[model samples]
Target chain A: MLSTQENAIIIEDLKKSFKNLEVLKGVDLTVRRGNILALLGPNGAGKTTIIRILSTLLHPDNGNVFVNGFDIKTQPQEVRRSIGLTGQFADVDEYLTGLENLLMMGKLYHLSRSVITRRTEELLKKFDLTEAARRPVKTYSGGMRRKLDLAASLIAYPPIVFLDEPTSSLDPRSRLNVWETIKKLLNDGVTVLLTTQHLEEADFLADTIAVINDGRIIAEDTPGRLKSRVGKERLELVIKRQDDFERAVTVITGNDLSHNSAEKTVSLAIENGVNEIQGVLNQLAESGIEVDTLTLRKPTLDDVFMHFTGLKPDEGRNEAA
Target chain B: MNSQLVYKKAYWMAGDVWVLIVRSIKHIYKNYDQLLGLTIQPIMFMLLFRYVFGGAIVVDTGTYVNFLMAGILVQGLAFGSLTTSFSIATDLQRGIIDRLKTLPIASWAVMMGHVTGDLVRNGLQAFILISMGILVGFQPTASALEWIVIAVLIVLFTLAISWIAAIMGLLAKTIESVSWLGFLVIFPLSFASSAFVPTETMPAPLRVFAENQPFTHVIEAIRALTLNRPVGNHLWMALVWCFGIILVSIPIAGYLFRRHGGR
Candidate 1:
């Protein structure tokens, strides 16, 4: 269990209103140390606003925030020294080279000359931009640019880093690389507050996930725990032929597997989970329905979000603003 | 804050500024043509004025080159400082300045670094204009120290204006408006001073306008030092002008940045 006191980041009763609309309404959260806390929210759920307060860039209209034991309102410098932020947009100078960006970030951290040099060399290699390090960032591919942004965030080795959609535009290869880097940060015991719309990213990387909608967190839990709360297993059946969909459903439900066929394939919420799934498969084979594929997997974050937000991840994000 | 604490703060603060500069320079290095614009324009203006304006215009100094050189250098420094404003606006638009909001560095360092870049940029503009000045017929009787003081003063002057321009940039709504914004700043400040012609030759009301304006003092101080003439009160007046701009624009820019700039 993570202690509410020992958590690296804590927000209590965070409230902010702009004229008539309230962006954050009495929000509370505790991000445990050495864990990746993915702050999942639709637009206007106040993710950026919360990030601003925790980074000491903005003060909340009401409530308090503590980052790395420093009160953001009173001890801004201490808080600043402790955290790293990579915003949703890449704010890097398009004219600067990949290597220059890291060195400059190193300079901001007040690293000595030799240390900056070593750190720069290390980041270039780590971010896999060794060849492109000297090229101006404007010439870099989108993946390379995002990696540079991520590398810049880590140059200081901050104990806590806030990454808002860090890998949104990255290709799968680069996205996986970013995931691996994030995993490495977890091993090093650095706390990460990540806000991302990519459900798969959250599903794989976040140890603790918070689903925020309408300026409030509707649900918060581990991926598996959150999935279990939906109260059923997800069984996806792929039909070998379009006409076989109805026949497969009869076999699945006949084995006491409750299911919904919303689209191309039929799904079931089964009992004894895998045992029910196994029985359905045997019956389908015996019935000669020629089912193409059958698999049993837990509900993903997408399903969990769908259950809470009443919309898919992309829909929730678009509708948020 | 104690001296040690302040130094520590400023030293760490320099990182944000330093990083911005290094990155900007790398940008400059990549686009050599942009730098070519810096060199090409003054050379064209030098040729245009010296050859065309040379035959008709007459100063007691006899050669039009001397008079033309000073004016070109002054105008180039003023114009060169405008790019700082453009770059600042671009950075703001691109969210580079927005990112700085999240750093641990001193709040003012980002603006300070940008103004310092103007200082350095104007210094380079000074160099190009001077080398071109000599290539015409302008001569300087002062030693290296005099030139250094004059150089520092020009930089300080450019920095003051860049601060003003930067404030305008942060406040501007769109990038297209940046050029117009810069133009608005320069139009009044440039023409109100002795940059174009001597104040004595102007009509009475215009002379008062020129004499009362801060630009006049800057031009007078610059002309006195570079031309090896007596500075008199122009030095004091120039300092007053530079200090006044810094005192006002820095705070105003900081305020605007804090308010509208992303948290």
Candidate 2:
């Protein structure tokens, strides 16, 4: 019984802990209807834990959650009925054909036999698994299996779908394919909450990205705003000679310049990339410092994450990978 | 209104169980090798016991083969029920349990569906083992009505054991642990009972343990029914054992199943 004014999902100071480890530390979030909210975080930042709590698979130790306007603690069935969940792993039965997997999901949704049949056919076609419909999932490639997994979640046309790291292990092409499927869901007005460690994924797919670290949402905003919050585009100059580093730094001084001795590069945060780069090049040339390479780098989601968390993305990515 | 909702929920749960049962049965059909593995073990034990160990064991019956048929059926079922464990463990390991948990259906339906599927499989194994027994000169002296009773009792016993297996499946940390746990239980229970030899032949303490175990009662009841012996308290004892297992296991299994959060 969600009112029109209510958000698709709302959380208030949600807390969950396992034994001595507190995974989610009093987190709050709101996902509006028909929007894609990406929960971007490093491993063990409690991204999956939050998704699990929202999907009613795990209960929060304390605090309140409403999914489609139903309290998750007291009205779990109502919450479950309103949401579809595609877990981090592809959860389809390997022995069953792609068609049977979808049909089984449809049956669990309490759809009629005819409706299940029709929906199974439509989903198979939609996910581009029509050719592989009769094949057992064990024989499918990783991308096809993921597609079928997502299709299984949509069998009942739930108002909201939770994709937990849907493209975590997918190759570039397969990730794009899943992104296409997600866009289709958005086109149909189905709200989506996806968790990912990939900044590029959040940048491309999320309407609003929540950057989480150490069990807290450190920053939340649109991807553009998040990147801008870090700083504007950066101007990078790789000096041809190591001795020219000091001169390059002097030219880019008063512009928040950072020098990397190992890479022999000088990077500066700039308000205007073109004008700043022009002035720096003129200054460097007048000072007889030959630049090996110069490029204007736009701010990416990676920069946004590093700026908010104060930790390099690679530090977390290495452990997660 | 609350009662009405409860009834509706029950109705939907039953339907969910049926759907899951169908899915499991389809899996068995597709992977016929597992089913083949199930049927072959009992037949091999029958052959080995009939040929290798038949001459050494002394039985009061006309032929040891007749006495061994019931024993083989009980042993076969005890081992066959492990398939339930492996299947459940695989589901949990592969994240299917989590998917089922998110669905708008009763949680117990997942376990019920698996037990029901294993029941059908155990039934088929029983049918094949009995056929092999008759072919190998094993004879049953039960009347048609008594035979029906034996079949129902065996299926009921299988259902009870499968519930215990389901619990092991949920609690097992890995798929490999499931088989080890099954071996630990099945090896002792099947060997310690009167399944392969008479309790009288065992030493004093071993006899005490073997004579009182639940498997002995079930084997004794099935042997009496098959041998046309006098109707005895073994039948009631077997029913109690089966009912006792179900009563103890259903709640524990359901609790473990609900507690499992798919790792």
Each model's DockQ score? 0.42, 0.50
**Lowest-scoring 10 consecutive residues by lDDT in candidate 1 chain A?**
A254-263
Top of the candidates by DockQ:
2
Q: Estimate, for each residue in B1-263, the C-alpha lDDT of model 2 and write its tens digit.
A: 69999898888888899999998888778889999988898899999999999989998878999989999999999888878899899988898888888889886787777788888888888999999999999989899999998987888789888998998998899999999999998888889989989999899999998988888888989998999997588888888889999999999998888888832
TM-score of each: 0.79, 0.90
Residues A1-321, candidate 1: write the lDDT tens digits.
334457999888898776667788888899888889998765667887778678776678888788988888899878877888885743676777788778777777777889889888887887678999888888988777777887788778788989887777678987888788777777778899998765578778999888887678888998667655653567777777756767776665632133345554766555466677787788888888876667766665456655776565556434333
TM-score of chain B of 1: 0.87
lDDT of 2 by residue, A262-288 (tens): 899887667766676678788888999
When only the first chain is scored, the TM-scores of the models are 0.78, 0.87
- Model 1 over residues B127-223: C-alpha lDDT tens digits? 8788878877877666687788787678778978888888877878888898898878677767666765566777898789888777778777777
* lDDT against true structure, model 2: 0.85
Docking quality category of candidate 1 according to DockQ thresholds: acceptable
lDDT of 1 at B109: 70
